[model samples]
Target chain A: MFRDITIGQYLPGESFIHRLDPRTKILSVLFFMVGIFGLKHLYSYLFVLALTLTVILVARIPLGYLLKGLKPIFIILIFTVGLHLFLTPGQILVEIGPLSITLEGIMKASFMALRLIFLVLFASLLTLTTAPMSLTDGLEKLLAPFAKVGLPAHELAMMMSIALRFIPTLIDETDKIMKAQKARGADFESGNIWQRAKSMIPILVPLFVSAFRRADELAMAMEARCYRGSEGRTRMKQLVYRKTDLIVTLGMGSAMVAAFFFL
Target chain B: MIKIDNVIHTYKKHSDEEVQALCGISLDIQEGEFLVIIGHNGSGKSTLAKHLNTLLIPSEGQVLIDGLDSTDPDMVWNIRSRVGMVFQNPDNQLIATTVEDDVAFGCENLGIESGEIRARVDDALATVGMAGFGNKEPHYLSGGQKQRVAIAGVIAMRPKYLVLDEPTAMLDPRGRQEVMETIHRLNKEEGLTIVHITHYMEEASQADRVVVMEDGKIVAQGCPREIFSQVKLLKSLRMDVPPMTELASILNEAGLEVDKTLLTVEEMVDALC
Candidate 1:
């Protein structure tokens, strides 16, 4: 059940987007999100949407697989579009019972849905193309300048990588705990919200205990291999910006600029 | 060489109870020797394994990796890099998502250049029989594969000595055999001193020397033949002898002419036929 998470999952490939440097993708995604939020026109979003779809096509990510990631967010999409459809203050275009469907309402609802869709697509695109460790490494390099003001950038990156490493292990552990609790007649499902939350206490307590124990053991193991906190560390896969990264960055910048002015 | 000079390790529990985990444990580990340590639970075997790499400094004694003092704070990383450690839990010891990244963790910590780290990571992965598994994640690998990756991680640093604390305790028979074979190759081909801690008698029988621990002290230390010959004493110390050794002892008890110290199936077949 926990494997249903598709946000952080990577679809390994040898496509152009995959070959782009992780730092370029991470930075571009950040700017893209900010830029998308600032756009005010439908046509402006259409341009960005077309660009994102083209990138996804270049990345060779199957549409079916990409849309599978939106399953969990479908309800939120429906709620946002539904609220905007009837509550948007605009001229009425059609009458259905007391709820009048206006042209402006239709446009606003579609805009909201499009923004949400774009948000998820861009986020997933970044994750789909970049490996989690590469992403963390890019973040570390980007955040390195802040280390002078006591940012603990290396520590943060180390923690993120470790967390990424343990994600599967912890998920398996949770599944085991849930199974064991079920075997002992513990009802996790078929309960009210409060009851379900309370039922998680048993699983959480053991998970936390095992997590702390794992943390302690992992710390010792790291120390045994002479891990002294990234002070003098060097990566085997060094992050180097290639010509592809430069072109990708420039193209993305110009596209965002065009979208902003064209609106 | 590891000179564990009368190392006495003491730690206080959360209840404020002072526990003496190691009691003046001194053993001279020669360079390029495969030494197996066996004991029951809480026998200071793990505590001693931790000392070889300076994971835990001796509370009242000294552990010297080569000639450097492990207790000296400045030399901890130096000592550790020279004496790498692989712990029992395969899931916990891995520090990176991918096998190559985890293997390079040690070399990265040592600040080796990117080019050299890449070479060493590939070499280390190949040495552990995990060459093509560089891009694989830890969870996708079997228990043996994960443990081998952990071994690869340590060997990437090119340590002179490798200390393993119950590395096979969590593996199945096949997985355990895989790890044992890899370790034997490391000791023979790479010429790395091996300090292996395990309760498995078969693994101990393959060691060049066996050190038995009990109640925070070394109870016996000798060749596998000498250690397993005293089956009664080992059993009394809550240790299992190799199956062949036990069978040979039974044959000896039943008025048969058999060497009670025989530790392998071939030896038993020779004795019987």
Candidate 2:
């Protein structure tokens, strides 16, 4: 059941969007997010929604898979919509008991909800199209300039990549531990909130121990491979900006600027 | 080439209850030698292997790799680059998400150019029979495949010697065979020195030389045939001899005319026939 969650999952595909450089995809998402926040009118929100749909089509990600990623955020979206609906004061539209819904409130809530939805869709599209390795590579390259100012960008990126690499491994470990505990008559499901938290101790302790052992071994292996900070390290897959990347950057920049001014 | 000069390693050296992991070990590993070290758990085989790559400096003595002292702080990286080490768990050693990237890890650490790193990654992957699996995620790979990728990661650095500490201990029989074959091929075809630390007697029987450790000391060292022929000594040390060697010894004890030196089934069959 835990495997059904696919928020940061990458769906491999051969498509125009998938072929774009990771930097291009990352920058495009950034611009799209900015445009989403800048939009004041409903038409602009629809335009952004249409733009997200076009990206989804180009990436060839299955609609069902993308929607599955939004499942965890459904409650957050509902809460945002509900907060705006009841709190925003405007001309009255409906009255139910002590609650009053207004025209402006409805408009604001729907727009806010659409913005949230489009934000998630665009972000998911980026991860769906680009592999996690490329994403970290892009992040490292994008942050390389900050390293000159005493920031440990390379180390941060390395940590992120390693964390991503270990997610599935740790998940498998968790599943195994959970099953082992269950076989030993450990109840994880039948308890209050505090009791459920307490029940996790058995699983957490072993997992933490194994994780530390893995970290120690990994550190030794890395040292054996001559890893001595990021001073002189070189990457095999050098990130290069191509013609398509430039075009995508220019197009996205123009669209975002247009959304801010014209809309 | 590597030399261990009376190396004594103690864990928690400053503590009163320090445990001696390696007790007065001395050995020499020549270039292009396929040396296998076999021992029971906590016999200090891994501790000895770690000394070869400077992962653990000796508490009393010294380890020298290619004439450079492993204990010297300045030569640590140089020694590490020369003597690559692969650990038991493939999942832990593989730091990169993709196989190719992991293979490129050592080269990258050496500050090699991107083009050179790319070539080395491809060549190393091909050497490990994982040529087309460059882009595959390491998590999705089977145990055998992951170990192969880990070997590729080490070999990509073009190390003169590869020290594997029970690399196949966590693997299944198939995975063990895969890793053993890769190690042997690297030693034979590439002329790379291999210091393989393993618990499998069959693996040790195939090595050019075998060193048996007991209680953090070398109990015996000889060719596989000579080593396995001493079935009583090996058994006394709580280590198993090769299956064929054990069977041959049993047959010989039963008044049958069998060669106790046989390390493989084929050799046993020839001796019987």
Candidate 3:
């Protein structure tokens, strides 16, 4: 159930998109985002929409899962549309209670809303296809050059991976702690917002204490394994780009660029 | 061989008050032998294990892994690589999400090449009887499997001496049994020197040597039969003997003809017949 929080979660599959190198997927997403932000005409938006849908279809991610990921951002989407529709000054289309809707406002709001939706879709699509480990590996390699600039590329990547690894563990621990507190007649539900907030303290205290203890033990175990830092480390999984990865990444990048500049 | 020479560790509790965790302790862990350390909590069983791998430096004295001193700044990694440690909790030790990656963690940290790391990971996984579970996530594993994975992670470093500190303490009975068998197999089949620490006397009874600790000192050291035969002394130190040994002691006290040195259920069965 904890894993069913589909936002930024991987859906294991053997689709064409899923098999692509994580670096390829990440770069394509970046290219599409840049193209989307620069597009001016409506046809380009339509082109980008069709291409996103095609990519998602190739990725074979269920429509329901993508929609679920967008649920948390629905309010933000609506707010963006509303603010642009009412606050922009232009040739008036309608007015209600000191708020005027204009022709330019209508165009602006639609584009803004479409932009937000496309951003969410592409971002979730990236995470949906790539396993968290692969994503972090790709990131570490991509960021490796920045190490000389004092970036700590490997450390950052390691932190990201370790954070992902512990998510399920922490969720289970939180569940256990909550149940233990509830068994002691501690109420977590059927309370006011403030009361519910207060009820969480009992769970938080023990969770923090145990998490710190785990951290201490983990550090010692790591030291025992001869882990000093990322200075001389080598990974088991190497990110290699295949023929399909190259073709797909190039195709997607150029298509987005074409849509943005020539559509 | 791992040699601990007069290791005295004084742990700072709030800086002002200090508790001596390991008091002038010296022990020789010979090559290819199964040695188990049994003690109650705060009896410095873990502290002694930690000293083996340089996780805790001796306040005064020395620890040497195959003639490399743990106190030497340059030899820390060498000492650690020679004496790999597996801690009590399996959940906390695995840094990678997947089993194979976690196994390769130590090898990677040691700067082994990619091909060599892969080979070692595969070999380690097979040795732990977890070859097919390389792709499995850590959270999906049972407690025993996780501990085995942790063991795999340690052995992937190619350590000669394995030090486990209460590895089965957090496991269920089945999990504990799985871990015990795995360690025993590693000790017997691979001829790896193992220094295990546990409070479970049953587990200790199978070791080549048993070291009993009390108040930060090794009070007794001998073979399992010899160690378990002194039931009253062990009981006085708040330690338990194996069930069969305890039964033998009880039966002997009742004027029955039973050997007090019995360590296993089969032995008890034979003596009863």
Q: Least lDDT summed over 10 consecutive residues: which range in candidate 2 chain B? A: B9-18
Off by over 4 Å in 1: A90-105, B247-258, B265-273
Count of clashes, each model:
0, 0, 0
Worst 10 residues of 2 chain A by lDDT: A1-10
| Model 3 chain B: worst 10 consecutive residues (lDDT sum) | B238-247
lDDT of 1 by residue, A1-263 (tens): 89887646888999988988888998788778767767888778777868888998999999988988888889999999989898887899888898988888999899889989988888899999999889899889989999999999999988988988888899999999999999999999888999999999999999999999999999998888878897787888988899988888887777667656666
The interface RMSD values of the models, given in order, are 0.7, 0.7, 0.9
> What CAPRI-style quality would you assign to candidate 1?
high
C-alpha lDDT score of every prediction, in listed order = 0.89, 0.90, 0.89
Candidate 3, residues A163-249, lDDT tens digits: the string is: 888888888999999889989999988789999999989999999999999888888888888888887888888888899888988
Evaluated against the true structure, the overall lDDT of model 1 is 0.89
TM-score of chain B of each: 0.96, 0.95, 0.96
Candidate 3 local accuracy as lDDT? 0.89
- Tell me the lDDT of model 3 at B39: 96
Off by over 4 Å in 2: B13-16, B247-259, B265-273
lDDT, residue A215, model 3 = 83
Estimated TM-score for each candidate: 0.95, 0.95, 0.95
**Stretches > 4 Å off in candidate 3:** A1-3, A242-252, A255-260, B251-257, B269-273
